[model samples]
Target: MATSRGEFSSSFGFIMAAAGSAIGLGNIWGFPTQTAQNGGAAFVLVYLVLAFVIGYPLLMAEFIIGRHSRSNPVGAYRAISGGKPFVPVGYFGIIVAGLILSFYSILAGWMVAYAVEPFFKLIGADDMAAWTVNQGNLSRNILFTSIFYLLTIGIIIGGVKSGIEKWSSRLMPTLIFMMILLTIYVLTLSGASDGLKVYLLPDFNKITDAQLILSALGQSFFSLSLGVGTMLVYGSYIANKENLVKLGVFVTLADIAIAFLAGLLIIPAMYVAANTGTEIFDEGGNLISGPTLVFQILPELFNSMGAIGVPAALVFFILMSIAALTSSISMLEVPVSYAVDTRNLQRKASTWVIGGFFWAISIILVIYFDKLFGLVVSFTTQYSQPLLGLVICIFIGWVMNRNSVLEELKKGNPEVANSLFMKVWPFFVRIVSPLLIVIVFLQSLNVF
Candidate 1:
């Protein structure tokens, strides 16, 4: 294991940084989409359970591995497994990190474009439909994508303490504050209560559907930033004295709160739009999915708000841009840590080289989004994430020596070492978590 690396300035810094990673586009965008598509509160209920059941244990496994090895993903695996055979797991994580960043940066770029829309007078223009049309223009997307990439790379190049932790501590609070403010304003809108009921009230029939359950499971994993080595990489920077369990709980709760608040804002806003004669539902009366809900539907919702819509749209996109940046910084850090640890490169050099490569790739993705975007997202999120998560669970629960794990867990909380969790967690990780992840993987394949 490497002896030298940056440590979080405080436990608060670590939690905030980790929470920032957890609270990203997945929370602000994906969670609301899934909730709208699934059974709303029913999906939220399952998602919460799964977050603790599968997400927390698996998160603990990654954290223990990182803190134990005291290195990057690749080095951590090698260090814990005593090298050879298992080292590729770490490499796999690095590759997954890069894959996620590629597509993630594209979406984040859209947020940047939207954030600038008010300044460009695009939000409430008479030709608002043209604004959406222009968003699809290849050159425009590339410009914004490149701009977002540069922002991400700039933060990552600042290194951990100066870059990630510092910004996370600042931006996370701002994100939350924005969400609360937006939620308050949105709730006061006419017909906003109708959206809130749809979001919070569970339809038992929809909740019982297999597809919705699977979606909730998937969202739980994705929202936690698990299965991509993000948590593992961040875990390496945590102070030895910090309690992993406490930290994990805080991060998980914060992520859930952000998503819930987003639901409050988005669902109510959608209803408010409906009150203003916008079609939030299709002819079949189903809520629209994915980009429709975000790029098209939400824009219409804000537009219906009259003059308030402009500033609302601005704040919403700014909040989204911040969310995207926090997550992107973590993704960039994975490969940067690998280069610094395994390849012995300087942090700034690794960040620039890796960030530049992804920036170019993100531009390609933006240009060919219709053909390649969905394919990349499906492969990475469906196949890669669950598969990697399964491998990590197996390695930590079965391959790595249990005594070593206990020793690591005992670092800050001796009580936890002897507690019931110490006894049950390994068993759950070994048998239960992997099985559920396999179910998620198969569900992704439509193999049910």
Candidate 2:
């Protein structure tokens, strides 16, 4: 059981895998749109602080516990608690992963559909191109959703170094390069300066707003892939010689950088859209957000560019699809790793079985699009994720001995004992992170 479970072949592979997990559809679509909907740079300022202060500590909780136990979230919890009730939390995390991927695959499918539409458009098959991007086409949605799942499953069936790491290394750089070029080009367009000003110049007064703070905190958690055991599973694969503290910082920064760049690319593009007579805001004056902003608003903006629009839209949706794929692979791995490590299942078979199950759920959600889709999304991400994260924090800070965590950190860097991380992190993970998460969770429910 111990020997068969794969380890990341190098620090680079792990960072690429882990960071790729963290940088997903949210960073590109949700984060920038949320920034615009909130107070723009004010929300970015708050999110920047929360990502490190709140997100990092919880992130390391997964890292320390995962490396110490060297197992999936379930095994890690049981190992830490010495066969106590905390084991259920691990199973709960696995359930959360499935539920998230169930709905998430649908969104990724939309990206894939949009990506494919440009090819049809290029071939002068305008009706086919129109059909691909039409949200009303259930067959199109289901088809692309299955395609996304197959793409994710294809990578996972190859195992760690060859599968997750290899694709992530190629995909992350490609995502970044395309992101930078798009940002530069969009910035060159007229009226993008308005969005640029909104993104870069903070409205300091709104930083103190409670809603912005809670939203930033929630985004930080979501963006880092914490509480879902994605990070925990990734952490389990890290080579023992790696400095986890350094690695954690690298992944977090990479996630943050991509999200920040998304703000640069996307928000500016929104203003550019507005300049071309597209409505950038809703009837209520809020910045259009979520799928509407991604699917409709942004696509309209692309279409207005005439002949250049086809290839540009292709590259944009492909970038979105790449971001979605990188993250989806990690989500799928949570269940696959559990089946492999604890259930004595094979990785390839486990991936297909679990991946197929989630795809089935995605199909169900697609069929019941008006009903189950949003419910599943809210349940998985908004509610269950923070609950799982809170539990993990409690496990490490309270259940596991403080010394045990210190010892795990010492594996890659002996200097961790004397470092500031040793002095501050234990306390932060135990108290600060849980409290912050609870606040965010409650705020999400409108209890405040």
Candidate 3:
């Protein structure tokens, strides 16, 4: 192994890669859906505050550990584990990352398939288009999931600067561009202004609701892809000369901006769909969420537009596919780095081997989708991630040596020495951030 694995080619490249990992299906679909489900702008307002209060601090904790060790997430944790039991927290994180990718690829596969569906339709191959959208078709699910895995693996095989950074630098801007164009298009339609009203105008009464606040906190956490070693791995790749404080703020802001921008598109489009007489809200008056919103409701909104609808759906799914791929590449990197670091494997071989393992798991989940899918998602994301995040705060806050942590940050920017972040973070990550994560964890227990 090279003494140095590799570094991101530039600061912009690093920012895009890190931000891309943060801005996934969650930002595109999950954020907006949560906004609609709660009291729209109220959720947005709370989520924004928590992004800085909760998300950025945890994010910095990962970056500090990551660059300090200059190793994989497991390796980084092991370097600081101080004991055996804590080591498993490192192992558990990659497991969560793997399980997350397994199901994540399945969702992204649908986006990939949906992106392709319009092509078939445009060519008059309506049957082929229908086949692509048919989730019950085992062949369809397997094929697209495989395609997504291959795409991720191909990028990984190219090494850090050439692969992950290069693609992220390209895809993130494209994703943003598409979101802007789609938002502008949707806003021009009749009734879209009503959605704009709901999305931008906060209902402070609901903002105080315990459940809504918890939901916003959870969205804030998960939207950044925290608790997974993905950020840690990305941090390990960051340059010593890069000012991580500025970089962290940049990535956090990018994530919030994109997720907020997605709300601009998604909510308004839902109202526009409602104007077309499509049932955008359920019997309880909550906006349709999860797979139903992406696969069914939004498609209805797109299709109601007549001739341009096919291409419109095409662009939207392509946008979703881009967002999904950017995140998947980062998730896949966690295990790939572990394999390379621990198993002494070649990065090329490791990407394929590890990606194939997750792909097989995805295939298995697709086969037993109804039974296993929800179980794995909840098990990995809901339970495992927050617990792992708790470990991160504990390690960075209470466990790791303070001088050592500052030494790492100093490598990137010496001025970080007396910064306000230095003044607040130690205490915040120690007491406040952990307490907030505990609240989020408790909320996940079905208590509101």
Error of 3 at 394 (Å): 0.3
Q: Summarize candidate 2's per-residue lDDT along 1-448 as a digit string, tens digits.
A: 3345878888888888898999988888789877876788899888988898889998898988888888988888777755368888889899999889899899999999999999998889999988998898899989999999999999999998889999998998999999998888889888899999888887878888888888888999989999989999988888789899999889889989899999999889999999999998888988888888898888988888888878889899999999999999999999998998888888889999999998999999999999999898889888998899998888888888878888889999999999998888888888999999999889879899
Q: For candidate 1, what is the total of clashing residue pairs?
A: 0
Q: Candidate 1 or 2, higher TM-score?
A: 2
Model 1 C-alpha lDDT per residue in residues 308-427, reported as the tens digit of each score: 888899999999999999999999999999999888899998899999998887878887888988988898888999998998888887788878887888887888876878787878
Model 3 residue pairs with clashes = none
Candidate 1 C-alpha error for residue 324, in Å: 0.6
Worst 10 residues of 1 by lDDT: 124-133
Provide the lowest-lDDT 10-residue window in model 2: 77-86
Could you report the Cα RMSD, in angstroms, for every candidate shown?
2.2, 1.1, 1.3
TM-score of each: 0.95, 0.98, 0.98
Off by over 4 Å in 1: 1-3, 122-133
The TM-score measured for candidate 1 stands at 0.95
Show model 3 residue runs off by greater than 4 Å.
Answer: 1-3, 81-85
lDDT, ranked from best to worst = 3, 2, 1
